[model samples]
Target chain A: MIKIETCLTPEILSLHQLEGKIAVVTDVLRATSCMVAGLNAGVNSVIPVIKVEEALEYQKKGFITAGERGGVKVEEFTIGNSPFEHMQEEYHGKDICMTTTNGTVAITEAKKTAKEVIIGALLNVGTVAEYLKEQNQDIVIICAGWKGNPSLEDTLFAGALIHRLQDQAELTDDASFMALAQYQQANGKVADVIQNYASHAKRLSGLKAKSDLSFCAQEDYCSILPILNGEAITIKKN
Target chain B: MIKIETCLTPEILSLHQLEGKIAVVTDVLRATSCMVAGLNAGVNSVIPVIKVEEALEYQKKGFITAGERGGVKVEEFTIGNSPFEHMQEEYHGKDICMTTTNGTVAITEAKKTAKEVIIGALLNVGTVAEYLKEQNQDIVIICAGWKGNPSLEDTLFAGALIHRLQDQAELTDDASFMALAQYQQANGKVADVIQNYASHAKRLSGLKAKSDLSFCAQEDYCSILPILNGEAITIKKN
Candidate 1:
């Protein structure tokens, strides 16, 4: 029997019994979204770094550095956190090293225990779900919530994924059920619900990142499965 | 400015930055509900212990011992986790020492950081909200989620409390807003929603704790405010 559990935030990642499970790490507004876009746009691979200095070290090695902290572009980096930037032709056919406030932290943590780790977002929900459907192992959806607290967008994205896979797998925990219920509550109107309720969206709006909000909310906008390979996220070439 | 944040599980309690804030600890299935019921029944004080052995020690000191582990009555305890037992005439005018699988652990953790800690449940939502309104401090609703994961019933109860306090307090973070939205989705039918989604309720049903479920769902059934006095939980005289 396949069981699916959700770690609603990275803060609780340690409490999850994740041995032998596949971890789908999500940061919908917008770190994982950016990575998915980069992989789909034909970037060679995306390396996730937890520190700005680590990203800078990769930049010194001639890799394109991209990330943000507190919703602003990091200093001395090649690009900001906007997923649309990953869609730029300049980054095509190149390796990108990235970090963000929450998503990288979650990915780094999940990698410690999960047998396999994949980046997930609303943009790649279909791709991630399809990949997980074929796996016979248990799944843990890790939501990269805002600064250690649960975020509406990530939970909604997890719910969207759960809604797709519920019939195929056991929704074994309350967080999964809660996320699916929240997703159902906002099923037909995802953008509107997220705009009004997501704290990170409101924070980004305050920082003039409205375009990133709209980009991150587009379901199945990207088809690439960005799976963690060693320390870098690379496209899973099936 | 009074800000209200909801920690959906004790596992993420550290991420909440709860220092100097008032912590409203909730374990809606039974622990906090029992504590609230005990206070309403005119119990002089209730002590929350983290271990079964500590509860036993308190029992040796003539305090009525009460608690459960894994949803079963602990061996050598005065009673199991039924709130109705707390409502019994025998417990009136006496101090009760209590512990449980999740709630007391959360209360013990919150006491380490919170300026004040109070028990919250559907049975005393109005009383808890009224008390918070009178205080000029930030509030953190710490949900004693089941075994390091978020529980639906606790989050829904937090949502119900948020629904009541949203107009008066700044719902400072995403968890608070997410919870309030959930409460709104089940506005007039909390019991039905919880019955269908809460994992702990289903677990209890397997253990034949149906009466406990019905009693825990009653909103404002008791008006007593359970607040922490050093290490013991006691009725707030005000």
Candidate 2:
């Protein structure tokens, strides 16, 4: 049986051996959701950088810079961390240099140890699941929690992916099982659950991103599978 | 409102500031459960040692050496990890020098940073909740997961404590919220939930300790509040 593991937060990612495994990194509040929407809207690729300064360097090289820190966009960046911003016609066919509070750091960390790194969010969960099932590789779902602490939305997203892959993969640890149980608890009212209970979602809502939360909570918004090939995240080739 | 935080595994305890906070340490599969039972059955105090060698040193000092490594009793020790053995009259009024795999390590670690450390298990969850509610301090429920990894039984036990204290305490982080949600999902069928899904319970079951699982799953089997006071876990004086 193919094995599936979960790193609840990037802090615990070191405890998991990522060699030869496909890592699915997610930040459901915004980072990954926007990445999916951006790629699906015809942005050529997303270059995830760890800092706003790195994104600025990419801006010098003619890439559209996008980032956020603590729910607000970095003033220096061209665009903020939002799926709607990424979906605009102005960004179509352009490569984005992106940074965010948690998602980019998690992606950078997972790419170092994982054989392949992919982004997973409600927007493209079904496609991510189908791709993993076809690849038949051992999997690790990395939740980009709020600064090394686990976040409800990211964990719930991990559970959603686990639930989809349960038939084809065996949960090898208690973390994966817990994620699945949490997902089962929050399946139908995911948006309501996050809006009402998730701390990060509340932070976003405070910044007037309630619509973003509702949009990110939707499943299969696009067929795009954002995979980190080297330093850039582009659509996975069929 | 009293704040309740959960460190899902002892590995994450360092991330939490435990000073001035009451720490509830639990290992539901056996260790903490048996500690509660042993104390209730009149074991004077439980000295949770990290190593069998230390327990042996305590044995030389006339304390009863009782511990298990991997669900089996040490050959040199007088007793194993079963709560039933701890409930026996033979061990009444004796001080137990104990060591287990996960629980003891967690207790030792928590004692270092927490203002007060108390043992928690299904066997004495009611008393734990009552004591914390009365103390009115910020609380951290530490789940002694399997060798630094999160365990189903322990996380569920944290959820149980969180559920009991939810009316009196505010959950401070996502881990506490997630634990409560999981507890809600497993409420009224906690034993069946662990029996069917907990990884540690499955390990114990493989070792013919199925009854121990049921015993550990029981609520308020004893009213004893075991608190660590300078190297020994003794009943808290009202």
Best by lDDT: 2
User: What clash pairs does model 2 have?
Assistant: none
DockQ, Cα level, model 1: 0.73
Residue A19, model 2: lDDT of 96
The alpha-carbon RMSD values of the candidates against the true structure, listed in the order shown, are 2.1, 1.8
Q: What is the lDDT of residue B131 in candidate 2?
A: 92
lDDT of 1 by residue, A39-139 (tens): 88878889998999999999999999999998889989999889888879988899999999999999999999899998999998988889888886799
Residue B220 lDDT in candidate 1: 85
- In terms of lDDT, the poorest run of 10 residues in model 2 chain A is A199-208
Model 1: runs farther than 4 Å from truth?
A: A205-208, B206-208
Under the 3 Å rule for N, CA and C atoms, how many clashes does model 2 have? 0
Model 2: per-residue Cα lDDT over A1-238, one tens digit each: 6799888888778889999999999999899999999999899999999988889999999999998988789998889988899989999999999999999999999989899999999889999999998999999999998877888888888888998899988888888999999989985787788888888775665444888888998877788888998899999888
